[model samples]
Target: MYAAVVRSYQESPKFEAIDLPEPSGAHDAVVDVLAAGLHPRVRSQADGSHYASRGELPLVPGIDGVGRLPDGRTVYFAAPDTAFGSMAERTVIDVRLSVPLPEGADPVQIAAAMNPAMSSWVALRRRIAFRPGQSVLVLGATGNSGQMAVRIAKLLGAGRVIGAGRDPERLRALRAIGADETVSLAGDPETAARRVGEAAAEVDVVLDYLWGKPAELAMVPLLKRRSDRSRALTWIQIGSVAGPEAAVPSAALRSANFRLLGSGQGSVTTAGYMAELPALVDAIADGRLSVNAVPVPLADVADVWGTPAGAGQRIVFVPTRGAGA
Candidate 1:
């Protein structure tokens, strides 16, 4: 079975085919690959720069995928924290880690949407105490997680959803995906903040994906303008796409009454996921949540991973040609 194996952690590691990996334990079931989700974190893992790097070579780098077991169970999983990932024709995963897909669902779409959707779901529903009718400002709104955040915020009854990104066209697309307003970060931080302030002053919640000076700067004034001190503005920091180090003034917190929180898959317990997965899956199956997935063959995985696409659109790698549903 062909798999994308990284021989070394160089600036540009070679992704090529290698021998199929065997299942290690009885609890680990081998999945017949169907589709895999490509994220920026996968590239970072390949380059030995990801936060969870084990410094191991010849790693299979993919974080999420949809596949089938020997008994013909269709499943999708958020890849475990290991070098043995989902970027292979056959890969092993613990049975508990895999979620069985609903019957007649699109495999590529499910694979693409799972990671981003889960990130948004976990961040909004679990990490932050998101209340209905609260206004939400989603930073980096054009990206995968940001777009999911926008949709999830709206579905969960956010009063107003504002999406902020660098691109105008992408911002327009965000509006179609449940964003009531879109703000471009092309201008200075003050300018961006003022623009957002004009639209909706004192946002109740902020879901921040891009960290760094710009994100920090843009959020500072917005946080300062919160209507009530004890009303509680929440900022959930999920990713650092812009840059890791952010310069934020401590003085801004006086009036904001904000709760800055970090959210990710690792933060949640296995038992928590068992309870949450059912509701999330039900939402997907019922069409309450939607994902924009671009289906590509597994052979084109490298090309798709090479460039950054729109934030809202997900790239799903389908292993079996002419396979759908």
Candidate 2:
């Protein structure tokens, strides 16, 4: 079988012929790869930068993808952190982690949207007790997952959604996709913080993707502007795109009724993620949650590995079929 093999953390994944691993676990089965997304998570996995990376080399880099099982069912499956990922003609998958796609669901679209969409979808559903009509603020709202967070918050019944990002054009574009208001995080820090405070001071929830200095700085101003400091504010750390560590203000935590927590692999259990998958899959399949995606041949993985996808467009790799057929 052929796969995008990563031999070093410093180099791009090359499409090369490799032997497929036989299933060893009770739930494991080799499935035909249909579409795999080139997500930031996948990039980090390939480069050995993700916290989950075990520094293992000579591996295939893909977290999750759409695949066809031996039983002929098309399902979306999440791959374990093994040498053989879902980037090949065939890869091992835990059958229990997969869910069958609804009739007429587009595999490419599902591949492109699921991972990014899952970040916010799972966070809102499993991380917090979110209710309809509550206001939301999405930090780093210009990125792929952040953009989806804006829409998901609205779909989940957020009364008002505020989007803040460093891209002025992208921030402006957020209003069309259910953001009640948008703030530009570009330019002078003081000015940007003030705008964020004014726009999202009273929001009930914040889905923060930028956690470094940007998130650290935004907190104080946002907390100060709140009309009622005693009101509950839930801040869910979804991604650390800006930076990992933040010198959080001790005063900020003590000043208001602020509750901070993370939402990801360890934070949300496997059962928790599985429980939310069905509803989320149905939403993406039915077009309730939409994403812009483009399909590229898996053979071109190495060439496009370092290239960034166009604004708001995710790249989904389509491997040549029949190898696993």
**Leading candidate by TM-score:** 2
- Estimate the lDDT of model 2: 0.91
Candidate 1 lDDT score at position 218: 68
RMSD of 1: 3.1
Model 2, 284-323: lDDT tens digits are: 9999987888999898888998999999999999998543
- The superposed Cα distance between candidate 2 and the true structure at residue 317, in angstroms, equals 0.6
- Cα deviation at 7, candidate 1, in Å, is 1.5
Q: Please, what is the whole-model Cα lDDT of each candidate in the order they appear?
A: 0.75, 0.91
Q: Candidate 2 — which residues are off by over 4 angstroms? A: 322-325
- Candidate 2 at 143: error in angstroms? 0.5
Worst 10 residues of 2 by lDDT: 316-325
